[model samples]
Target chain A: SAVISQKPSRDICQRGTSLTIQCQVDSQVTMMFWYRQQPGQSLTLIATANQGSEATYESGFVIDKFPISRPNLTFSTLTVSNMSPEDSSIYLCSARVASGGRGIQYFGAGTRLSVL
Target chain B: AQRVTQPEKLLSVFKGAPVELKCNYSYSGSPELFWYVQYSRQRLQLLLRHISRESIKGFTADLNKGETSFHLKKPFAQEEDSAMYYCALSNSNSGYALNFGKGTSLLVTP
Candidate 1:
């Protein structure tokens, strides 16, 4: 299990403003992922953050709207650019920890963003 | 493409009653299935995995490859079991990330 933390646990922002959510892991991980959970809905993978490289965004999500930066193995950030009311959602960060023969993924306490 | 499907959006059961949460997957290759639980105000955590074949918190799930299903089941429900449950799948050979289903909210009432 990994101890992960996210900054700005909850935030309210005006429309058209951008916010960057930070994810910090207690130990180095092989993979880091970003997800978005709409109210009363399921989680959607936003992107997969790769250290020292550009992140891979999922279908329906673009780099220009949600830019990601993973400078090191233990830290990553996702910036919601030019936000709108529809962009309000719980953003979660997860990491894969090597264990046994395979690895298990763990999630951070999500950042709940409310775009007004 | 790998995908997970949880049929129920909400399920309610009384304490000591049996509970079952259905989950199905669509993937061509071998899949690693998992059940994740989120309690109120707590971070989501892994409850159990099909590969491990270990029961956690009196919950057990068996992978039926023929049916492409991994349903979570328990004989007796408890009040503490009220929470959100998500079914996830990962390609055995693909990267270690998961494709999650729309979670099911379980309400175990006394």
Candidate 2:
């Protein structure tokens, strides 16, 4: 399994300000995903970041609101643009491990964002 | 539409007692199921997957395609087993990104 590291484990931001979260995997992986977990809610898939290409966003999510980047196999970034109070949640970074056979996704510790 | 449902929001049990966490999923194709656990102040980690048919930390889950469920179970509950458990399903069409349940908070008391 690949170890994922997320920067800025927690942050507090003002409304209308955007925040970018970084996810780094210890090894090269084929698939990277971004998920948002609202307070008292289940984790929802935001998008799948494809290496060397634009990310595929899930329903109810747009690239403008949550732009993603995967420049390489071992790294990806997700930015929550034009933030609001509702945007406050835990943002998780996950990767499909090459060795985990059958593409098991491993998650990062997640970034807790509080918007006021 | 692939979805994972964990009916119970929380489950409390006495230590040394048997414990079962129910999980149900909806998917048209053959799905892969998994159980993930998050201990206090720790990252979410994979506890077990149905394909492996292996028990992890005294816990095991059987994928019943007929019933559309993959409930996790343990013979004896341990205090340290208390944590947030999430049941997930892998949709082959979606690059294997997990569809997670709402999660069940298990509490083991003395």
Top of the candidates by DockQ: 2
Model 1: CA > 4 A from native: B92-94
Residue clash pairs of candidate 2 = none
lDDT of 2 by residue, A14-94 (tens): 999999999999999879999999998889999999797779999999999999889888999999999999999999999
Model 2, span B1-110: residue lDDT tens: 88899999999999999999999999999998999999999999999999899989999999999999999999999999999999999967988889999999999999
TM-scores of the candidates, chain A only: 0.97, 0.96
Error at B101, model 1, angstroms: 1.0
Interface Cα RMSD, each model: 1.0, 0.7
Instruction: Summarize candidate 1's per-residue lDDT along A24-74 as a digit string, tens digits.
Output: 999998689999999988888898886767788888999999999898999
**How is the predicted docking of candidate 2 categorized under the CAPRI scheme?**
high
